[model samples]
Target chain A: MTARLRVVSGLLILAATVPFASWWEAGLVRHVLGHVPLLVAAGALLAPRGGRPVGQPTAIAAVLVAAFCIAFWMIPRWLDAAVNSPAVDAAKMASLVLLAGVPVGWAWPRLAPLARGFVLAQLASMFGILGAVWLAAPVRLCNNYLVDEQTVLGRIALAVAVAMVVAGLVAALAGPGITRARPAA
Target chain B: MRSGGLALVAAVVAAGAGLLWWGTEGLSVFTAETARREAVALAPRVLPDITLQDEAGATITLDALRGKVVLADFIYTRCPTICTVQGSDFEQARAAIRAAGLGDDIALVSISFDPEHDGPEELAFYASRFGGADDIWHFARAPSRADTGALLRAAEVIVLPDGIGGFIHNSAIHVIDPQGRLVRILDDDAWREALVLAQALADDTAAAAPVAGGAGT
Candidate 1:
C-alpha cells in the first residue's frame, strides 16, 4: 500500500474511534453509521490488490471468522455492553477492525468470483432480515437506544441491504476479470 | 486438505456458538434487558437497604416495608408517556387490591429514579394526580442519586436520558416477596398478574409467620 493510503486509513481510524465513536453512543443509528467508516478503512488497508489465490481452506476460514465477528457484535446484549462500558467499547472496535475487517480483506481477492458473490448475497440478506426484525420488534432491543431511534436504524439497515445488492449485481456484471487473482510477482 | 478445512470450519462454528451462548447468558435471552429480568426471576435477590423519602417527606428504607409483598415500579414524574400510563395503572391496581380486601397483604410503591428532579414535592403532586398516596400506595424517591442508582441497579431497571429532559427507561412492575426479595418482573400492564403473585407470596408469609411464632412460644 502507498504511504498516502496508509496515512488516510490512519486518519479514518482516528476519526472513527474518537469523534464518531463518542457520537454514536447517544443512539443506535449513529452507532451503526459510525462503524461503517471504520470497517471500510480497516478493510481497505489490508485488502490485497493482486496476489496468487489463497488456499480454499484459508479463504473459507477467513469468511467464517468475519461472519461470526459481525453476528456476535449485532447481538443486543453485546451491543448494549459496547455502549455502556468503555472496556467493551474498545474491545468492539478492536475486534471489528482486526478480527472482521482484516480477515475479510485478506480473503476477498483470493476467493473465486462465485464465492465472493455468495458472501455478498448472504450479507445483503442478513441485513434485510435484521432490518425487518428491528422494524417490527415490539420491544426495544437495546437499553441505551429509544424505540424511535431503533426504528430509524431499521430503515437505514434496509437501505444498506438494497445498496449492497445493487453494488453486488454491478460488480458481477463488470466481469470476473476485475477481481481475478493475478499470479504472484 | 478438504478434511482439514472441514474440521477448521466445524471448530469455528462451535467456538462461535459457545461465545453466543455465553453472551446471551446461557442462551436464555438475546437482549440484555430480557437477561436482566430473567436473571432476577431465576434468582430473586434481596434489594439493598437504600433510604428513600416518601411523598410525605418521611425517610424510609426498603427493609422497613418487609413482611408485606411490595409491587414496585421505577418512574420519573416528568415522564411524558409511559410513566403516566404506569401511574394510572398503579391507581387502578391499588383500587383493585383495596376492593379485594388484600390491601393489608399487598403494597404498591413507585420509586422515582430521577431523584435529581423528582423531590418530595414533585412526588406528592404526581401521586395526587392518581388519587394520592395512602397506606396502600406510596410515592417515594431516593433522596441521593447514589441511593437511587443502587435501588435501580438492584431492581435491574435501565434508565437513560432521552436528551430532552426526560428519560427513556424500561417499564415493569417488580414484585417483591414478603422477605424483600425481588422475585418477578411483570409487564407494566400486567398489574393483575402482579396482584395475583403478590397475594400468593403474602399468603405464604402469613402462613409461615404463625408457624415461627408457635415455634418461638
Candidate 2:
C-alpha cells in the first residue's frame, strides 16, 4: 500500500471507531472498558503495525466475536425513531455485547497468535467474578440506571463477556494481514 | 510477549464482574402508594367559569348543570388505584340515592384529570362498570389539558400522582345548586355524604320548582 493508501486506511479505521467512542460517553463505559484491547488490536490491524505479542489464535478468535457484537448493537438504534426511542430493558443488555465485540473485528490485524488464549482467560475470569458478585450482593432495578436488566452486576458480567469475545475475534482475523504486511527488507 | 496483555484482560474482567454484582445484591427499591382521603379547606368565592364537557362530546358550560343538584368528582381511569376507589365510592352513593327514589332530581358528574387520554369512551367504561352511568351520571372529560387544570384549580381540589403511580390529593364531593354556584362541599364525603347530598340537593331542586311538588308534597 502507498503512503496515501495507508493514511486513508488509517482514517477508515478511525472513522469506524467514532460511534464506539460516542456510545461510550452515552452510558456505555462499562462495555468499552471491558473490551478496550480488542478495539486497540483492530486499530493496529489497519493503521499502526504491531507485531504479535503472544497466543495469536486466541486473540484472532476474539475478533469474530467482536464483529458479531457490532452487528447486534446496531439493531436497537435501527429499530427506534430513526434516532432515539424504544428504550427497553432488553436493548441495554444487547448493547454491552456489541460495544465489546466491534473493536476485535476492527483491530484484528494487530492481535496475532496470543489473542485467543487472552480472550478465553478473560472470559473465564469474568464468569467467576460475576457469580461471586451475584452470590454476595442483593440486586435492584430503577428507571435511571441503564445497566444490564437494570442491575449493576449484570452490566459487569456482560461487559466481561463482550471483551473476551472481541479479543478472540480480532487476533483470529488480523493474523494473516499482519503476516502479509511484513516489511520487504 | 502477550502474557501481560492476557493477564490484564483477565484481571479487568474479573474485577468488573465481581464489583458490579456485589453492588447489585445490595440494592433495594422504595415504593409509595399512599393517598389523602380527607378534603382540603378552601375559601368561598364565585365559582370560576368552566365549559364542562357532556357525555355526547358537546361543550356544556358549568351554567348548564345549574338549576338542579350537581354532584361532581375528579377521576381518571388509568389511575390504577385512587380514581377507581373514589369512583366506586361515588357509584355506591349514586346507587343508594337512586334506591331511595331520588335519582331524577340530582346529577352526578366525574371529570377526568388526564383529559388527553381519557375521552368519552374511557369515561363511559368507568361509569358503566359501576352502573348508574346513563343520563343521571354525567361522565365529563375535558377538551384539553388547560381545561382540566382550570377545573382542578376552580374546585380548590388538586390530585397529583406519586412516582409509583398512586394519586395524592383531596377527595371532597361538591354540591352545586341549579344556579351554577357551589352550595356546599361534603368533606371527605366518599359515598355516604354523596348519598345525603344527592338526596338533599334533589329536595332543594324539588322545593325550588313548584311543578315537581305533586308526589312529594
Candidate 3:
C-alpha cells in the first residue's frame, strides 16, 4: 500500500479504538496493544524517507527512547494513572504517537544492521520479561484492570514477544548483506 | 510491500486480532468462572487507614476497627438509585452477622463520599432509614472533599459526580479483615459468603496472634 493509504488506515483504526478505550476492560486492551502499533504504522508511513539517513548514533538514541517509552507505559503505576487521570491519559497518547512511534519509525531503518538487531533484541526481552511478570503476579497489577484481563494481556504479549524474537533470529541468520541499512543517499 | 514490511504487517495484524478478541469477547485461556474465583481468592490487601466522622460527630478511624471484620460500603444520602439497593444488601449482611453471633467481631460502616450533603445528621437519618442499628452499623461522611477523594483513591473506588446532584460510585461491600487489610470486596452483598470469609479471616488472625505473642516472649 502507498504511504497515504497506510496513514489513512492507521488513523481509521485509531478512531475506532478510541471509543472502546473509555471502557474498563476494552480500554486497557486498546491502550497497550492497539494504539502502539497503529501509531507506529502511521508514523512509519509518514517518516522521512529517501533523504540522507540519520546518523547511526542518533538512530540508536531514538530507538532507545522508543523502547524506554514502551517500557514506561507497561509499569503498573503508569497504567493506573492513565486510567484515572485525564491529563495522564492525554500524555500517554501524545508520547506514544508523537515521540516514540514517529522517532522509532524514522530512525529504525537508518541504523546499521547490528544496531537494528540490538534494538529488536531489547524490545523482545522487554516484552518477554514484562509478559512473564504480569502472568505470574498473584495479585492484580493495575487497579483499573481485572486479574483475568491482565492475564490475557500477558499471554498476548508473550506470544508477540516470541514471534518478534523468532523474526529477529531469522533476520540475523540471513546475515548483514541482505539486512544491512542502505547507505545515505 | 517488502518481506520485512510484510512481516511487520503480520505482527501488527496478529496483535490486533488478539486484542480484538480480548476487547470484544474477553476470550482468554482462563475461563470466566476460573478468573472470578482467582480474583476473589487473591484478596487481603492492606487497606489505607483513613479517619472520618461518624453520625454522632465522633471520629472513626479504620485502624480502630482493626480487630473487627469491617463490612464497608460507599454511598451518599442524596442518591436515588443503586445506593438504596446497596443499603439493603448491607443491612442483610449485618443481620446475617448478628444472627451468627459474630456481631461484636464484625462491624459495618457506610462511608459517604459526598460530605457536602451527607454530614452527621444526614448520615444518621439515612442510617436509620436503612435499618442501620446503632451498635452494629455506623454511617459516616468524609471530613473534606480532598480527604474523601484521597480515601476513595486509596480504596480504588471510582466516584464520578453524575450531571445530576448525586454521584455514581462502585457499590460494593468492602470486607476489611481484623488486620485492617481489605480482604474482599463483594458487589453482590453475598451475605453468607461475606460471613464465611470474615469468619475465616477472624480465625486466621486469632490463630496468628498467639504465635506472635509466644515469639515476643
| Candidate DockQ scores, in order | 0.60, 0.05, 0.04
Arrange candidates by DockQ, highest first: which order?
A: 1, 2, 3
What is candidate 2's lDDT per residue for B38-102, written digit by digit as tens? 12223333466677665567676667766667777777767776567777777776676667766
lDDT, candidate 3, A91-111, per-residue tens: 776777666677777887788
Top DockQ: which candidate number?
Answer: 1
Candidate 3 has which clashing residue pairs, if any?
A: none
Query: In model 2, what is the error at residue A41, expressed in angstroms?
Result: 59
Return the DockQ of model 1. Answer: 0.60
lDDT measured at residue B131 in model 2 versus the true structure, 0 to 100: 75
Per-model i-RMS? 1.4, 11.5, 10.3
Each model's lDDT = 0.84, 0.53, 0.70
Ranking by lDDT: 1, 3, 2
Minimal lDDT window, size 10, model 1 chain A: A175-184
lDDT of 1 by residue, B1-217 (tens): 7788778878888888888788877877888788778888899999998888999999877788898899999999998899899999999999999999988889999999988899989999999999999999989999899988888877767798887888888889999898889999888999989998988898888888888989585
**Model 2, residue B43: displacement in angstroms?**
6.3
